[model samples]
Target: MTIIIMLVAALLPAVLLWLYVWKKDPQKEPTSWLVKATLLGVALCIPVAILEMGIETVLFGVDGGPTNLADTTIMAFFVAAIPEESFKLLALWLILRKNPFFDEHFDGIVYAVCIGLGFAAMENVLYVFNDEEWVTVAIGRALLAVPGHYAFAILMGFYFSIYRFVDKSPKIAVCILLVPVLAHGIYDSLAMSSIVDPSIGGISVLVLIYFCVKMHKVARKKLLALKEVDKCDNESSFT
Candidate 1:
């Protein structure tokens, strides 16, 4: 009963987001590949969790950790952002490595969003399913965390497309991994700091809202920009 509802709540955002990204692609990739990429994302969560635990052990020695802004930032970046985004990037590469459908710029973002939402869906289940404030947590994550992952994926895929078909330099290649980590890290750090200092919770929440809004706006523009580029290429090819 409760568990069923929780599962639905956790997954609803991912489903909506999946459709959103899928519809935005004018020339959709094969559904089979997207589903495979998404399942890889779900499977990658296991490795990502293990890697975060290992990093946490090395950083704080299996005990109390990240009591302040600086340490929290470290945990956010190393423990959370770096591990998760790096694995997703690796997964993206593996999915597209020999993919014949990797023909356009926007395909990158579409596939990346599928993988990201898969990861987010599993993660949302973990966070909201076990909590006592299940409804609140579910709603908050649907609004924030799920979208944050979507935005981060856009950043990764935006830069990935550039690296793959445009620049391919050391710089743009690095952005494929770097931009998401920075965005994810900053988001986590801002959100997590409140746990250490209740007094600053309000300020942190406000900042987090601004950050999420700003990040989504940037990611949205990038997604649309790539979509337009793909459309232009298609039009030019037909002429």
Candidate 2:
């Protein structure tokens, strides 16, 4: 029963967030396509895990987390944000470039979010399994970490749609990968700093709280904007 609870705690956030983003899409992609995107995220865990660990070992030493602000920032940006978002963007591109269902501005957001949540669900479970105080870890992750991924996904997909349907130039194209990497790096740096430097941990937590609230609000607005964009696209089609 404890295991069951832990599993639920680990996964529920992803499911809820995925559903929230899916609901925001005016023209929902088929369920199977969405599932494929999600499963692709799950599938990506193997490669992402290996790459992250290898980078950390080579760059920072074996299993050694950040020791200071600089270390934390480096690990966050390189080990966590860059590779994760790159793989996600690559997956999004490979899957959706030729997809018929990926027709609207919002579809990018939907598929990207589905993939993010899928990765979050499995990653959360891994965290719970490894931690001694899994209840705390699970609860903390469900509240913050999973949502962080959700926010990053929204950022990625927002730019992804623009890059895909609006402009394909090198500048606009990079935003799909760059925006999410920056956001994820910032969030991870802040969060990791709290752990690495307990002296200012309180300050770090306060800032994280502020950042998360602001980020979620922005993510919501972006999704709402996508809905409006779909409406505009539809109206233009008939006119």
Candidate 3:
């Protein structure tokens, strides 16, 4: 009974976060794509999570602590960073990129964030059920992991928008996702590491805030450029 109560407490915050983000679309809301993307993100996380566990088993031993510096770097880079970023990218490509519904730069953020928040929601449920100290896990994920996922998605979508307009540089957008992945890995490493002081957690949170602001600026700039192009097109048509 006690364990069940703990799981409920942990799961509620994640569920609420998912619902809030899922409902946040203001215009031309994408209900079907959002559902599909979210489900796909959650599904991909399962295999990636399993692979991460296996890698940790061999590299960090069953206890999951690093055996050496190289192992530590690989664990952080591959298991934590690459898998998370790639899964979100896969969700975006699968749900939004090829769809006609993805008409604007803002849609990138919308669809990508929904998928990320979905992944976080499911990941949180798994942690909540498994962890004995479910309350702290729930609070930490609400305060940190969920926001981190949103922030990363925003970055992914932001660069993708840039790639769309800057004709010769499409592939660069994929590299841009690395920034968020690195930041995410750093945050995870800091929290997991015994070497660092707890106060530095603020730095990780600040990274998310920084990227959010940066992406907002980029989106605004892109929208303005698009508006200018549309105005030119309108004038040309009239002439």
lDDT scores for all predictions? 0.93, 0.89, 0.66
Q: What is the lDDT, from 0 to 100, of the residue 148 in candidate 1?
A: 94
- Model 2 Cα shift for residue 55 (angstroms): 0.4
- Candidate 3 runs further than 4 Å off: 1-24, 62-64, 67-74, 165-171, 195-239
TM-score of each: 0.98, 0.96, 0.73
Best by TM-score: 1
Rank order (by lDDT, best first): 1, 2, 3
**Candidate 3 per-residue lDDT over residues 110-172, each given as its tens digit:** 677677777777887888788877778878777767766766666676666556645436467
Q: How do the candidates rank by TM-score, highest first?
A: 1, 2, 3
- Which stretches of candidate 1 lie above 4 Å from their native place? none
Summing lDDT over every window of 10 consecutive residues in candidate 3, give the lowest-scoring window: 191-200
lDDT of 2: 0.89
Model 1 TM-score is 0.98
Q: Give the distance in Å from residue 222's predicted Cα in candidate 2 to where it truly belongs.
A: 1.7
Candidate 1 weakest ten by summed lDDT:
60-69
Cα deviation of 39, candidate 1, in Å: 0.6
